[model samples]
Structure formats: C-alpha cells, structure tokens
Target: MQRRKYLKGMATAAGIVTVSSTGNAQVWDSDELSKGEEPKNPSPPRKGDSVMGLTDQIDTVNVGIIGLGNRGFSMTQLIDAMAPDKGVIKAICDIREKPVEEMSDWIKEEGKNDPPATYSGSKNSWRKLVQRDDLDLVFVFTPHQAHTPMAEYAMKKGKHVAVEVPAATTIQECWTLVDTAEKTQKQCVMLENVCYFDIEMWVLNMVRQGVFGDKLTYASGGYIHNLVAEYFFEAYWKDWRSKNHRKYKGDLYPTHGLGPIAFYMGINRGDRLEYIASQESPETQLTERAKELPEDHWAHGADDWANGDTTRSEILTEQDRQIHLQFDVKTNRGYSRKNELAGVDAYHEGFPSQLAVDSEGHGFVDDATYDQYYEEYRHPLWVQMEEIAEEYGGHGGGDFLEIYRLFDAFNDGRPPDMDVYDAAAWSAVRPLSATSIEYGGIPVKFPDFTRGDWQNKRKLQVMDFDTI
Candidate 1:
C-alpha cells in the first residue's frame, strides 16, 4: 500500500531498517503483493509442445563434455581449438579417472583424426554421453546440483546444452530448465561467462548509446573473489563446494555477481527481478578458515558453516530497477568484480573503476579514464573476440568470449544469447537468496522467466558484428 508506505517511510527516515535479518517486520501488504509469480519457467507436460524460437543449425558442432574437473577439462581445451576448425570432441565424461586420463592425453596431443570417446564409467556416464548419435552439444561442467538435472538430461537427450553456473538449483530447478528447453526444442546455454566481459560489454555499450541519459536505475556487482586458496581443491568433488558451504544460508556464490548485472539490467529482456532482499555478512572465515587447512585438506573436514562469508543480495526491477548483489566467497579478497552502474545521468563505482558524468557534476570518473572508455566503447564482440579471448584465459576474455559467442549463437541459427529465459532468471539468485536470508530479510518475489516474452524481448544484442 502506497509503495509499502513509501518504503517504510524511507527506512524510517534513515534509521535504515529496510528489513535485513531480524524479526522480518511483516509489511508485505497488497494481499502479499498480489500473490506474485509470473517470471516464467514452469511447464513440462503443460503438454510437450515446447519450442520457443530459432534453434536448429549445426554445421559441424559435435562436442560433448561432462566435468573432467575444472570446467569440463577447460571445455576440452575449447574443443581443442574447435577441432581443426569449427567443432568436434564428440565425447568425454568424468566420474574422474584422473580426468579421464587427462582428457585422453589431450586427445592425443591434438592430433585427433577422430578420437575422444571416453566416459569414466557410470555415475550415469553422462547418461551415455547424452545419448549421443555423434553429439551436437552437451558441455555441462557438472556440480551445481548437477546443473538442472544435467541440463534436463541434455535437452531431453537430443543434445544442445551448456551448463555451469547456477544454471539451476531451485525455483523448481528453474522450471526444469524451462520445461526442458521447451519440450526438447533443444538449446539451453547459461554458461554466462560474465555476460561476455569486455568491460561488461562497455557497460552494455554505454547503456545502449543513450550514454546513461537516465532511468537505467541501479546495479552494483560483487563476487568478491577470494576463494580462499583458490577453489579449495574444488571441495574434493564428492563434497561439492564444501557441501555447498555446509548447506546454504544465502548467496552461496551468486553467478559472478549475478552475471554482469544481469546483462546490464536488460534482465529477461525488458526488465524483471521485481523483489528480493538479502543480508548475511557474518559467519566469519568459513569455519575459521577451514581450521587453517592441512587435515590432508579436502576442505579440512567441513562442519556447520551456512554460507554468508558475506552476502548482500537486494534487487528489484519490474521497471523501478535497482540491484546490489555481492557475495564474498570467503575472503582475504583480491579479485574484485564489483562493477556498479547507477544511472540518472551516470555512475559506475566499480572495482577501483569509476565514472561519474552528468557533466562530472561532482566528479570522479578516472582510473586513468579506463583506456578512454576502452577506446570509445569497444564491444564489437570485443572487436572480434579479443584475439581469441586472450588465448583462452577465463575472465580476461570471459572464458573465450563465452565460448565464442556461444558457438556463434549456435552456428548462426540464432536463439542462444543465453536462453532458457536467461537460465531461469539468472539462476534465481541462489534459491531466492536463500529464501530471502531465511525469512528475516523479507521480500523475495521473482519468477518471470519471460513468460510474457519480456515485454518484446530483443535487446542485449551481443554478436552480430557484421556476421563476424
């Protein structure tokens, strides 16, 4: 009612209690916000008929990978540099037989005349490499609760997928990855490599050329990287991310600060998020820094440590926009991904990165002018994938320009600019920020995985650089 009494009278005139873990001070009127729920993702036999758009091209693809430790053996060396042109690694799984014999000796030191068929035996040998018939796509670097049931069993066993990231962990596994990519129409994607970072696509091409004239409201990032001892031996596999930081509490690794601010806040396409509040920040050094390691370290015998080495969450959109994110993966911090963007005129307080504008009203935009706004708004897919994504070094080339613009938007047939409704609304910010920080932070709402087709969809246009 009356915008929740004008946001609780502007947080009680600044005493600032916008609800953050406490007795969750009721408030949510309007019949519980009209019983929210429309952000899509929830059909599967709402009668098979599922297809959404585009999705069909192939042209040599063939790939298949399923966790050979660390992002499916670095995406099988990006399909061994796209197997002598284009694609083909055909198969490779890993219940771990020494990373399936070191990815079969890197496919015989990349001399593949047609090699790759390995599968470290059952744990559902990636269901026989996604029922391959000479594959087409399957990727899925497993273990995020096995990304939406292994990408809904490789798009219902017809292939074409691409897991990793909170591709699905709830929101009913993101509506079972949107009813199995719409009843097997295929194409899944969600490997959200920081929405193909290149200075966050030049702050999303300077807010799509308006140069932040106003309205793009807010966004602030943070995956404050400090994976203490980098990746704690990937929580010794069977222990998966330290038993999900001892069974979640909040933002347990939100998609690299919620995927480049949900791709510059184009959210599903028009804007969605709606509600979500979170808090956390207390649970000092994950189990006292895992008892200072060395118990033959396999996450040094994990114990109760329900996340929040620092959580932050906060988001709301349906046009009013606003965001916050941040989730410090147990810190001593070093890698910062905090890129803020709050426009009315301009604002960008990111990791030592700044930007002010409104004609420098109060001034502040200088980190030596970020290479002059990266040579004036680069992003033509970083001028053709920054020399092959800085030779495949994740992030500084966002995992090879998010796998070559997701396999050139799936071999040019389109439909894959991160789909399945942006992987269930950006992996439903880790189970709605752990049920709004265990009901004490309040306001959760968010679903519209684009059922109403994101009010006209089509924006966030990455890659179309004159047909590459």
Candidate 2:
C-alpha cells in the first residue's frame, strides 16, 4: 500500500505525462498506476501430471508450418534439408497466398515426391492445418501474439508444437501452454536457436564437465541489436513489432538472451527463476524517430511508445544464484547475446568471446589457449552436425542444429532437450519484468510452472550426444 502510494504521489508530482496518438503529451489516469501490483498466481483448474521425461517416438515427424514470413520461410528450407529420413513438410500456411504457393513450388523443386498442402488467405487458416490428422508436429513461426494460441491449439489437436522464441507474451498464455502440453501429452518446445550455437554448446559442455568449477553463482546475458529499420519500416507484415513497442513497456523480447543462460545454469532442471525486478531507460529514441516519419506513414500517428530504449532485468534463482538480462533493439550497435557466466574457478563472456581461469592474476587466457579450449571442449553435437548445419544455413547453423536435435529426440523416443516447463519459465521474463518496471522496479515473483518438480535433477537432453 505504501509503495503504491509513493508511486502515485510521484506520478502526480510529475503530471503523469502520456503521449496522445498525434504525438501530443497529456495527463493519464492515476488508476493506471495500479497495474503494477502483483497479480494472483492461481493454479489452473485442470491439473495434469508432470511431463518431465515424456516421450512419443515417431518413425518420421510429419510437419506442418504456419506463418511463411522471413523466419517461417527460412525454416521450410531447413526442414527440407532433413528430408524424408528425419521429417517431411506435409503442409504449410500463411495469411497471404503467394508465399504459401511459392514455398510449395520450392519444396516440390527440392525433389520431394509430393508438394506440401498449402493454407492461406485467411487469418484463421492455420486452424485447418493444425486440425489435419496427418501432421505429427506443427511449427509456429507466426507473429508474437499468435504463438500461444497456435501452439496450444496444435497441442490440443494431438500434434506436438515447436514455436519461435518468447513463446508467449503474457503469463496467462505461459500457463495455458504448460497446461495444454501436459494434458495432451504433446511436446511444446520453444525454438530458441541460440541455445544450440557452437560457442554456447562448448560452454555447456565445459560446465557439465565441471571445468567452470562447483557452486557457479552468477551469470549475465542480453540481446543487443540495431533493428531500427526493421522495426520502424514495413519490414514486418503489419508493423506488429513496432506496435508492441507502443503497447508495452519493459523487456518485450527476452528469450534470445535468457535461453542459453537458462541451459548453462540448469534452469527448471535443478534451479528455477524465483523472481525478477527490472528498470528501463526513458522512452526516447523510438518516439523521436516516430516523429520523423511522413504524415502518410503508419507510424506517423503512433505517439505512445511504451517500451524504452533499453531494459535491464535481474533475476534470483531458487538456489540463490543470480542472473542478469538485458533487452535493447533501438540502439545502433553490433548484434550481441552478451552470454556470460561466472563460477568460483573461472568466468566466460561471449560476443568477442573470452574465457578466464583462476590463475594467480586471473585474466583471459591467451589466443592459443582459447583455440585449444574450442578444440578440446567443442560440444559433440556441434562436432557431429557442423558440416550439415553449415550447409543448411541459419543463424550460423544454430537453427539447423536445433531442428536436428529436436527430430533426433523424436526418432529415439526420448524427451526433448527443451520442454514445456522450459518454454514457460524462459518466456515468463517478458511479463514478469514488465510488471516489475511498472511497479517502480519492485521484485515480482515468477510462477513455478513445474509445480515443485524442478528439484528432481536431470540431464539436459541435448547433452546426451553419445547416441549420435
């Protein structure tokens, strides 16, 4: 009560400045201040048993794809690279007809016996694709808001779902995914390709081998990229990316930075995110750029930019480990996932890639030593799939590696490397941090989607590469 009062007083003193659609500043209702209060974490009415090691082996994964944009189209090509042995694209969908038809032709050209069935020209056309009894797996590469609904519907239809990053936008959607996946006994995997990057995998191998030493306590990572042109222009189908900036505050996109760190730290495996607090820089860069658009541009009328130029969130784990995450896309900077991990004996930071051991001085090792570490500790999966992944080509081959692992697990009738709990836990950062920032950086509790099952120690399925 007192904190809310203080925040209200501050808002009143500062006049609660809110931007109108025409880029004019105006006073907003103080009632909006109450939005930051911690929401009730209610258990779902329908309970489902834990799917910790669930498996449904498939002879071959018959795949259906929704959303044929840049990411979706690229994924089709990657799936084609796997072909009839591992999987096949049975059907494809999009809101527009051209891409669907074009992709079908491309797949036909790739020497498949039959072209994939196409669904398009309707917003809800994806439903028909998911309802198909032939599909064993459905890939959702749609817009952010559609991820949860499509994934849930697919799971309920008895098909496993693989969705793009930040699998959900809200906490409710996160729970919906968890519950649906559990009840239906279908996999709900978030396609976080960064988790499969060669450098990230090497680090995972080192951590598993105890090279980072015991009681690893702290780590930090972030997504820093210059997407101004893509976000502001017509790069998106309907400028949905920028609309999110105008509709929400705090870390809008978080999984790219958080996913690999979660794996390194064993999130939802041994430890889980307990709570998060965040602070965001004032909204300046995006709003200023929005004003520069011509009057006829869609963004010309968009004045209320809710997200900030940068957002920093801190998380505490159940084991008292600390994690830091950052989200930024407006700034002009080289792309980085800022992957960093620190333990008692050593430290590692990516994006220029550095590694340090506990020597007398304790600094980054020499170039030769770094090269040796890469040679010695390179993850087995990377060693096995590097050539093929490179040939397939997506995000330095991480994308192809991720798909290969997913299908490998399916073929072997083993649980996936990532599961529904992981999808929920990692994507929960977006809403949790937004609430923290809204309530003046108050710490917000994270719902343990695992329902106390995370304490059972288990190996990450991806690390079990001996089968390869």
Candidate 3:
C-alpha cells in the first residue's frame, strides 16, 4: 500500500487517476493530460463532467433487484407497494436459489401479472438480471464489498442504479463508480434511508429556513449498536459483517450516521469534505464475546479482530464545518445514530431528540416549543407520505420514504435525491477513516468526488416537496 503524494490540482484535473489502496492517487493534472502524458491508471471524468442532472424519462420504471438477502427481501415490500403505478419488479436475482425462488413465489402470491424473472445458482447470476433490457432501474442490495462493481455493471448496462448504503468500500472503488456513472450518463443513487428519517427531514427543512441560524458550526453522528447476539451470529447471510469486522479497522458502517449530517451540511454540493483523522479504542469486548459462541461459529476462536471496540473520526469540510463521527458494534449498547447539530442560534440532537433555539445559553426548548417547531417545519415529503410510511414500517418509516423517493424520481424523470458524487463522497469515509487509523490517526485528505464542482451550490431535490 504505497501512498502517493496528494496532487495539488486533483480537483481541477481534466483527467484523474484511480486512487491507490492507501487512499492516495497518481494523478494526471490538466497540464500533464494536455501535454499528452498518458495516465497509467484509468482516469475519472473532468470537473463539471457529471451525471448530476442526468435524466431518462421512463413511463413506468421496470425494476430489477439483485441480492435477495434479508435487506433485499424486505425492500420488495416497498417496491410492491409502489408497483403498477410507479414501477414494477421485472426481475429478481441472488446467488442462492432458495431466496430467489422465495421472492418469485412472493411476487406470484402478490398477484403480479408478470411475476419477476429469477436468476440464481451462480456468482455471476446477477449480471443476467442487470442485462435485462426490460429493467429501467436496478436496485442493488448486496453485501458492502459487491456494491460498487454491481452498481458500475448495472449503469454500464443501461439501467439506473439505486444501491444500498456505503456504496463503495475503498477510494478506488468510489472513483470507479463515479467514472462509470458519468460514462453511462445514468443515475447512481445511494439508498441512505437515514436521510429520510422524520427528525432528519424536519431538521433539514428547519436548516433551510434559517431555524438553525446562518452558520452551522459543528455536528455529531454515529452508528453505535450492539450486534454480537444477532448480526454476528445468524443475521448477515454469510457472516459478511462479522467477517468484515475481523478484517477492517475503520468505520465499516458509516453512512447510517454520516448521510443525514452531509445533507445538513450540503456535502458534495455547496461544501466538500477536506480531510479526516480517526482513532479507535483497542479491541477487547468482541474477542471476549467471541468465546461465548459455539465452536462451529465463525467467531468462536477468533482473537485477531481488526476492528476495535469503537472508532472515532473527526472531519473538516472545506467550509470549515466540523463533524464528529463514531462507530461501534462490539459494545453492549443501545442503538443510536447520535444525530447532533449546532449553530450560533440553535442546536438539536436525535435519539430522544431535543431542540433549543434563540441563544446558546438557553437549554433545550420545552416540549411545547419542540412540538410547535415540528408542526411548523415538518417537511412536505413527510407530510404527504407520513401515513403510508408509518404503515409500511421500516426504520421508523425512513426506509419506505427512501424507496418512495427513488421510484418517484424515476417516475418523474428527475435526478434522485442522492447522486453518484454523494454516494462516493459518503462511502469514501470508510476507507479514508481506515487509512487515518492505519497511520496512527494522522489527518487523511478526503477526495473531492465531485471534483471542483462542489463549489457550486445547488438545491436538493428532496427539499422540493411539491414535485412528488
């Protein structure tokens, strides 16, 4: 893992090379590219060469979903709920036959006129689903490692992609996805459901309306949970998550916490992530907990878990906005994303969700004021879809809202709420954090996946509630 020098004009380069495994790049600056210096690595698209406003008007989004695992299977309900009107599931795929067959049967039981075509039995089976011309949109809910390649493949095959969170595991993979999406001129959206959470949306609306004051000083977020009992044992299909914990040292699952904060701070739009430094607590609990598992369990005798009990990362935005993120799954703690925000005039925090405004000296506002703010600033999307979201019920209805927005964007022939740059920038935190930790918590430069275009401010589609 050789670290290349951070190029001075990477953001301005006409063609940029793929990042190395160590999160550094061997770039071809605009001068070199203009002088006919061929880049050894594949080059990413130039600044402002983006799929930001890419559009293809489809009357009905013919959907294909790969990976019929737990998360994938659950998403079928959301897709089903939107079928015939917004989109229809045209194909389904998995490496295992059981889940694929089960999904097919479920589609049949749901009385779809055309039960989705199923593909399975081989690792490459998903390519069949992606290659289907009938599919206008593809939802990739595969494991973390496969997300980037799957998304790149789907986009190159002429289908819009909506992939599950943390779309790429490495900086190189992030560049690959961004380049593929740009080359294909197709939408590559990361399905970060947390951005659609009720509190998050409401706070976003408030921030836009100046409720959080003019300058947002700092924010805090985390993906803190205790997963040893379930996810480490039987939850993940092949112990993928546990295995990742055994191999990786950074914030493996960062999007759940980072996505909402990015939206609040306008990452990859009006602001860019400049750099991050990360440190982790020593590994202790997971090793001790591994002994409790049966001998046949994957973690039964595992003592060399690369992940520590906790990891903390501090990020600086180009606008000088500070963000603090925490990741921990080895602890026996209650679930929380820690969503916290602060401004000169107001402050808020999620998980018991308190709000205070008017002055920093003032403590949290009374319940009455908080409830009033909710009534006054409730996001229009939530206002319109709250009933259905609550009924569908996934992650306090954020999951349904996320799916709704995806299909809604497809139906209207508009850019999704999150595009490739957003996906790449958010997911890059995983690798960037890991690299920082690897170097004893030195600050690692964060890639501007949007290139220099992050300087241009733009409105988020999610804020435009009147459209969908």
Q: Rate the local accuracy (lDDT) of all candidates.
A: 0.71, 0.84, 0.83
Could you report the Cα RMSD, in angstroms, for every candidate shown? 21.6, 6.5, 6.0
Kindly report which residue stretches of model 2 are placed more than 4 angstroms away from their true locations once superposed: 1-42
lDDT tens readout by residue for model 1, 1-468:
554553554343212222221112234443433444122222234334434455677766778888887667776686567665567787788887788888888788778537788887679888887897888888888788888888888778788888888887777778777776777778787787877777777877787776677577788777887775554665453547767777777776677777778777777676767677787877767677678888886667565678867888888777767788878867786778788887777777666667776564868765567677767877777776688778867758678767876676667776667777777777777777777777667666676655666776574547345555
User: Per-residue CA lDDT of candidate 2, range 381-457, in tens?
Assistant: 88877888898889889999889889888998999999999998898888878877776776666777888889988
Residue 353, candidate 1: C-alpha displacement in angstroms: 49
Task: Give candidate 3 misplaced runs (Cα > 4 Å).
Answer: 1-48, 234-237
| Ranking, lDDT, top scorer first | 2, 3, 1
| Colliding pairs, model 1 | 38-448, 39-447, 39-448, 39-449, 40-448, 40-449
Error of 2 at 366 (Å): 0.9
Q: Give one digit per residue, the lDDT tens place, for model 3 in 170-265.
A: 988988888888778888899999999999999999999999889998999999988766655566627478778778989998999999999999
